[model samples]
Target: MAQDPPVSDLTDDQAALELQRLALVLSQANQAYHRDDSPSIDDASYDQLKRRNAQIEQRFPHLKRSDSPSDQVGAKPKEGFGKIRHRQPMLSLANAFEVQEVEDFVARLKKFLNLAPQSHMRMTAEPKIDGLSLSIRYEKGQLIHAVTRGDGETGEEVTANALTIADIPKTLSGAPDVLEVRGEVYMTHADFAALNATQEQAGQKPFSNPRNAAAGSLRQLDAQVTKARPLLFFAYAWGDLSEPLAPSQSEAVARLQALGFSTNPLFITCDTPEELVSHYGAVELARSDLGYDIDGMVYKVDDLALQARLGFRATTPRWAIAHKFPAELAWTELLGIDIQVGRTGALSPVARLNPVTVGGVVVSNATLHNEDYIAGRDSKGDSIRGGKDIRVGDWVQIYRAGDVIPKIADVDLSRRPVDSAPFDFAEKLKQEGIEGKRAPGDAVWRYCGDEPLADLAIEALKHFVSRQAFDIEGLGAKQIEQFYHRGWIRTPVDIFTLKSRFGPGQLQQLCNLDGWGEKSAQKLFDGIDAKRSIELHRLIFALGIRHVGEGAAKLLANRFVTWEALSEAMQSAAPGSAAAAALVEIEGVGEVMAQSVVEPFQDPERFAALQLLLAQLQVSPAPQIDSSTSPVAGKTVVFTGTLTQMTRAEAKARAETLGAKVSGSVSAKTDILVAGAGAGSKAKKATQLGIETLDEEGWIALIEGL
Candidate 1:
């Protein structure tokens, strides 16, 4: 695999390619780790890839792919097990590699909630168990189902196996009518060692690690097999609750304990980032001493209400982050440097190192990052590695962090070969017969050819039929590439028209192809036909518009309701116009993203293609929020001034839950305004616009009833 450049250094096209690669890689990694109970990559490497993917998506929002890794959790349930769809998705947490990132997480929360810097906030810090995630649901104080966190939305039914675990309660006393306790199922060090010993004595293959052992044991098809395995569960969170667990996260954990579930004893509340970091350090220091394996510390907003207000991203909670432990480091000799071309044609330098052990993993290659990095400088031309450039046969200090790709941390100048000289990256590229030039303001030297554009087109088509998009089964990436080269499928619309164009008696029939037989070709056509009607969000994502990722697509779909409405809104949204303002106001869609969303509608060629595509398919309207009982549902609301009843953040969150669109500024579109004691310009504007007005007390009364 080629080394990824910094998120800031990637061009839009490069970012899109990176997203596609990450999506594919991470999806496979997830299936291996979560569903198969076998991880192909180490934790550090997996985390690094996930982090890099997220950073790239963040930097190039418009180029975010529909199958982005950030929006996915776990993998599909393994075969041979009955599937159970979770009422609430078992979401993964965002990660923080550094203490500063924890601070940033806290800062983002405050900013999102419109909280003052001095406002009091609390977060709960707890050890992140390195084990399988399990969700045990209880109904009417009785255990109904126990499932593995297969994919976020669905899982493998393991109720019979769960009954064998002593730590897991068979039933709950005085619990909510519906409660889903989510936690980690782990094996202690002693148990793992004993289990491995038993396996070896029984002439069976021993497990690789405690986490894997626990997962394999818990997921066994035979309940008797699982009953013999020593397993423990620690409840940390809940899903699909009929009633609130508690006022805060810490209290919720206690509630779980009271309800006959085991909870981690180290879980505690912290008031500041410093305190959280201190707890992380304490946990890291105690990791070896603890019987169970722990990878990091998880920090979440303590207040349950605040967490609800903060809400969730596509696959992670906005109110929480996992602070991972530091990476392991080692030294190695730089044998050679190899340049690999990426999907977008950028030449990336990879350092070939002597096979050395780093954190118990054999390392042979490391990411050189770019030419600047190889020259012992950063992108801004600042000195790195003490201004000593790397050379062949030089001893270097390497660190394996959250990536399988180790990186050179420092040069052992004292041990450098006297005859060695600084390796010229440009000269090496030339010697490799790669001709390219680095564009101004770009760090990467991309291939100066039209081949990359063709690659991009194929990639775009692949994304169009991706699992998260149209999800046309039997038409995978390989098929897409083959079809592209064969001139059978050129565009998304062409995919829907395949049956018509390549059916029986046509000049070119898919069934006539060497590899594709009648049944397979018919199945392919059926797959294409099955996707002729797609949901609004999936269709928007299938368009592959810059900045309009799956999450953003869903937001737009929900906001506009229908395809025609969205098309009209974007087409009418001129620069600096009120329509543009409204487009940007859709939460998570800012100015740059808003511009990207409008560009397709403005472009003559793109707009015509879009119309043609629409003609080939039926796009269902966005899923409507069930707020039929609320009078303010689907209304635009603005809040200004000091409310006596609730905080502004609470008010906004409440309104949104009732299907009201909350806006910062008052406009002609404002449906109603709630005037508080210190109501200002917004209130006046609302009154002038003839929008319905109400007092703070009246506002509370209007939304009080169910």
Candidate 2:
């Protein structure tokens, strides 16, 4: 198999070097295992390395050279059948061997997008079969070709031999007009046993493992010989389309089954983390019950929209995450704690360790979570939770929690070092100077400082004057923080009055502060004066009530869209007033957030100060939302290329807000092609059939007119 290019950040030569190394590693292992039957490395080791290579390729996208081996599939089709190209390029996933890695991956995913930590992820789980990869193509709802995954880019045609498998379709019923189905072809333990029994009676070579047996069977020179074996195809994924098919990932799998495809029924939808674990457990418990071979179960995010947002890494898609079943175990030491701070200041303790292999990965860390989680104490002290009890420097038995994370299963307390003691997280926090801002949840420390309110106010003010709101330059988070710390500002009102104290003439007084320079102070005053007039909705939101974040702020402001209207509404709804409850009825405002908004007005002193600040400010309201801007503005559009009108991301976000849906690999459902420069496969596909395609200029023109 060809290696994938390293991610874009890597130097071209560096990417090439990594690609060559990956190719050599995988090629050696492949030949040793498939041809010589003398494996150079175990499956876990091979899988882990491959996953690592895939990850590196995904991150440095600019390094993606067309010649990368990752573009090719490993299997060739048998000589008899005609081959069809996959509608969607089949990419593999980058993986993790431990909970910390998986959690870290999740955290990184969110951090890159500036999302909340507790933000829910939609994921799905399925069994990862240790079998030959196969793709089936259908057009006009008729069987076209069955091909092996050659290099992901090209494969040998194997339609004739694949046709012999009963589970596969020669012609599928209820299939969409055009479809490409992907799945694994495998020989089950029972099927392989029976086949091998027949082979033994005939004095032929029996296979070693089901994977080997299936691969050997599918690649046979004689179609008749392969026909004699009972091989099954369990469809997991497919792409290329004539029309839109399923709405969600789970729905798509279900539809695949309805189309005469032998899809795995173990695929289920789960909403919560605990529910997800239960679903994973159910699959694990039934590992032997299933007739076909599944080396591990795969969990993917359930939401297609979220999946689309997370898009594909070179090897795998972000929308979905995998949870593989346990395969092996490794022993390691829980060296010490490395606490990671989260965006919301949650403290999560990670174990620092001497790296050791478990499940083919050399895991050096695992989650310790919180102080309550250490010393065999849970948040509620119930058996220390997760059946995990281990201390720093203790010998720990680690196993793949579904081949996803290296979970500590046991601790040899007898092997604990003499220096080992109950880890005092408090002492560690004090040393780190993070004890004051202890994480809100389980044993964690934060840097909350002496005045949490001032810290929070600074965060709020930063948002208030942000580009999207007031567009105030020189009044960024740093200035807000500095002002709050220096006692120059307390609430949003203090900002409007600041120019009076630190005038252009008195800017000499402003200079000499750690970050302030004469030029910077003058720029700050100019910015403050320039933003003397802001949108009314933004002006109302600058007060920074407890629960009024961006979404809430927008909703509250838009409901009235001006400070005068908003204040009047608040006064009308004060306490038991019907007007206040009416304000609560606005979408997105719960009773708690609504109460927080209205109750702030009840504070006469605070309200009076806020009003005084407002008196000095000149603000106007936005024209109006015009309701058509709500996602699905009652129109449809398609997009392709390096969208000059906006980033493909920005265009898609706008489309979604206007109630438009984006599809990968265009189809008949596609409406308007907001094609940007350098449009490729999509524009080609759209044009061959006379599908309307727009150039960047045309898209810009259309949107401008809209």
lDDT for each candidate structure: 0.82, 0.65
Which candidate leads in TM-score?
1
Per-residue CA lDDT of model 2 for 1-706, tens digit only, reads 2343325555544454455556655766665554443456656667766775666677766665464546533433335445556557666665555545556666666675577888866666677777788888888867788767754655556777888999987887777788888898887767877887666433244665667788778777678988988888889888677765676788888888887888777777765455566766676666655665555556666766666677876656765555655565566777778666543345567888788644323468877666666667667667653544566778877665333545666677678888767777767777765644553553455556554444345666776666666666667656666678877877667777887766554466568665568677778778878888877656655655656655566566556767777777776676667886787666557787878787656779768976787787887874453436453355456676554224554455445544556555677766666665335577667767677776655555555455
TM-score of decoy 1: 0.49
TM-score for all models, in order of appearance: 0.49, 0.42
How would you encode candidate 1's per-residue C-alpha lDDT over 1-706 as one tens digit per residue? 2454567776664565556556766888899899988888878778888988878877888888777887888999999899999999999988889878888889889999999876769999999988999999899988888999888999999999999999998877899999999999999877988998777533245787788899999999999999999999999999999999889999989999998888998999989888999988887766656777778899999998999999988899999999887675677899999887654457788899997755434578999988888888888889987898988999988876533467889998899988998888778878976777888877787677534455656878978988789988688777787788988888888888777775446534565665567677778788788888999989988888866777778778877889999999999999989999998876667898999899989999889989999998988997664688788998998877656446665577567867888888888888988765445577667768899987665688898866
**TM-score (C-alpha, index-matched) for candidate 2:** 0.42
The residue-level lDDT of candidate 2 at 60 comes to 67
Off by over 4 Å in 2: 1-22, 30-41, 51-83, 108-115, 326-706
Residue 576's lDDT in candidate 1 = 88
lDDT of 2: 0.65
How does residue 705 of candidate 2 score in lDDT? 56
Best-fitting candidate, scored by lDDT = 1
